[model samples]
Target: MITEQAPGKLYIAGEYGVLEPDCPAILVAVNQFIRVSITKTNSAAGIIHSRQYSQDSIHWVRRGFKMVIDNRDNPFEYILAAISYTERFCLEQHVKMKLYDLHINSDLDSSDGKKYGLGSSAAVTVATVKAILRFYNVPFSNELVYKLSAISHYSVQGNGSAGDIAASVYGGWIAYQTFDKNWLKQELNHKTLSEVVSEAWPGLKIQLLTPPVGLNLMIGWSQQPASTSRLVDETNANKAALNGEYQQFIDFSRQCVLEMINGFENKDIHLIQKQIRVNRQLLRHFARINQIAIEIPRLSKLINIAESCGGAAKTSGAGNGDCGIVIADAQTDVTALEQEWRQNGIMPLDLHVHQSKIKQ
Candidate 1:
């Protein structure tokens, strides 16, 4: 059996702005992960299993170079897409395929099956692609894995800046600028998967960051799950009507994120925390102009408490609800803060940053 895992991610800054090409966002890979394991099977058909789904198992068969599944409303859509794209790349590299039972397990969700807003879908896609490639004994790099996984994810979801995918593949603190989706979509129409993966994608950049010496990150779950895609789509629909406000928000967000990146490089925790506050305010203005609630009531309370404790806090991701992140000095004791959060109906997560095992 071959196994692989990918870490979940949280957006630290540059929320709405990152959707635009060349706009930068800061994110961190958390310890939570999605694991995918592949085992060779003697049966003619392969099985895919996950406890998250209601079905016992989904059976699939290879029919003339395509995988056919029995279920139409399949919950393993991302996994299946990853398999299909990885097989295409394998074909290009002259790798033989075989029947295998693929199993998936996730730590990015709650015990009761609620997402912690940790980017589980992106992690699962990266894990599935990595597992299949490892199973085939194929020589690959992290960039190759990211490209294949991104293609698979984009093919299915059809939106977002893909910062989560980058964080999952790279597995650390990262500064990411989204690639031009229009260019990628056009390239996909005429280029092979291998060829496209080798090309320099326009506006795409991923830089691993070094955390400051005394930086401490904390996560608080609001217990309310959110749909990132739905919020993004709603924001996009309202962008045109906002006139110059949308562009202003993008410009401010870019500046805030850039300064935050500088803080990381200079090991200035104060500057980083200040920018976190700036980013939060920018998102507030963004919400006002777009007429969307990026920070709900619970998230507002969460941030207020963190700030009262001398930490910088902000709503993570699209953030109608889900989790809020806090950055504090390592010397500070957060026991009281955690206790206060619990009292306010928030669950403080004991998640740490996940460093990448893959060498750049």
Candidate 2:
């Protein structure tokens, strides 16, 4: 039997700007996760099972009906996608494999009426690619797995930088640069880019706060589904209008990132909190990527609530109906905030900044 797991993630900085197709973004791996465990049956058929989800069946076969998400579509489709892609690649490259039973699972509980956002999705991809490689006894670098996972995600989720994928896989505070589409090559080696911009200081501490009661952490649905296709279209349409704004926002992010780094290095809680608030505002201005307002009033209210408690808050993903991130003092009473959110039907999470391992 083969089992695998990966951590969910949050895009702490850089969302819309990475769409330039040239620039890179930064993300962090939160504590949430998606795990997979599987054992191949010698019955000439590959089965897929997700205990987290009460659905299981023959997902792939050697000669019978082909396994596909549309047929076995569960939360594990992304994982299978990576597996399928890797399998095909391995076949083409003649990578050998042994048959084994497979079981897939995830610690992320989005179906529990809790919203951890897309971090689980990224985690699935990371874990899937890793599992597949291990099952085949293939020797691949972490960078290679990250790239493969990114490619698999792009195949299904349209356009997304491997930045979040990188953070989830590498587990650290990384400065991501542009990635090459060729999974064999592109890696998030932001240290090189940082050296290019080395004048921006070095030590930066990014603190993520998860309220105990889940108050102040809300996911607005926009009450309307915004498909990736439509969002990408609008993004392309706004290109001309966004060029200068993008540059300005990037500059703002860079500067604020510097301040954050300095504050973290100096251990200045007041300065870090203030700069986080400022960065949150700047990111919000750049992230309004939709036509309908995603309950800005509610979001604003939450921000105000957090601010009143001596913390900072902002939208975590591509806004217009996504998760919000809060930065609070280490000693802030998160339970009180969580209680408030629970009353409002919102559940908060304890986001973690995972340690990064750079084996150069």
Candidate 3:
């Protein structure tokens, strides 16, 4: 049995701009993760199973915030895409064999009538590659693991910065620089990142607020898929249209990152709230890149509400439609505010960062 696990990530800074290659971003591994267990079987075709989805006969099972699937065409299209690429490296080294019965499980859920902002797709890919490595008993370094995982992530997410995968593999706070097409990993390193990781993460304190049942969380859904590929292609086509603007966004994002880093260093709740407010405004720049007709309203309101409660909040993922993140002081009145938000049809989730080594 080969068991591999990968941590889900929260992007503290530099998201939309990092969609373009060569834009640095900051991301950290959270307590949440996806775990995969591969049990080798002597069979012609591979069999994938998920314990989270309990109905064994059903190919797809949906429960409260859980979607589990067995076997279907393209059952794991994104994961297999990454596995195939990773296997290329293995094959080049003359490794050959076919193994079946790969079981996947995750903490990310989109089918429970809700979406969390954490990158489940990226987490799954990271877990898949790690599972493959474990199954092959390969003693690869974290750098190589990150390399293969990033390739898999881009295969599905497109033009990614690899920050999320880096956090999952490295298992800590990481100041990630974006990948430049012409630049190798060694050239674009930033020095302050080390200082931030060493000094900031150790001192930072956070509180995650989880709301009660039957409460509504404000979510903005375009009801349309925002293909990461289309976003990248659009930016590439209109280099004159958005390149400069995106660079500015990247700069602002980096500034916010620095601010948050300093806030952590100082444990200043006020400064953190201020930076989160700025981050939300900068998210608007993503609208043009995603080809949206207007800004998402419900999301905007929820963020305002959270801000009113002495915290700052923002969308968690590619936007268009997804969950949001709320950063508040440890002493914030989350229980009362959660009740208020629920009465107003908003759900609150208490998400916290993990300090221990993630289990497989």
Model 3: weakest 10-residue lDDT segment is 196-205
Global lDDT scores for all candidate models: 0.90, 0.56, 0.58
- List of clashing residue pairs for candidate 1: none
Q: Count the backbone clashes (under 3 Å) in each candidate.
A: 0, 20, 10
Ranking by lDDT: 1, 3, 2
Better of 2 and 3 by TM-score: 3
TM-score of each: 0.93, 0.72, 0.73
Top candidate on TM-score is 1
Q: What tens digits encode model 1's per-residue C-alpha lDDT throughout 1-360?
A: 888999999999999899997679999999998999999999989999998754425556687999976331243888999999999999999998899999999898898887899998799899999999999998888889989998988887778988999999998899999999999999989999899999999999999999999899999999998878767878889888886988888888999999999999999999999999999999998888877888999999999999888899999999999999999996545887898899999999989999988744
Candidate 1 — which residues are off by over 4 angstroms? 55-75, 330-333
Reference-based TM-score, model 2: 0.72
Q: How far is candidate 3 from the true structure (C-alpha RMSD, Å)?
A: 9.5
lDDT of 2 by residue, 97-176 (tens): 65655566666555553334555666777787778877777666665666577667766665555566776777754555
* Reference-based lDDT, residue 359, model 3: 35
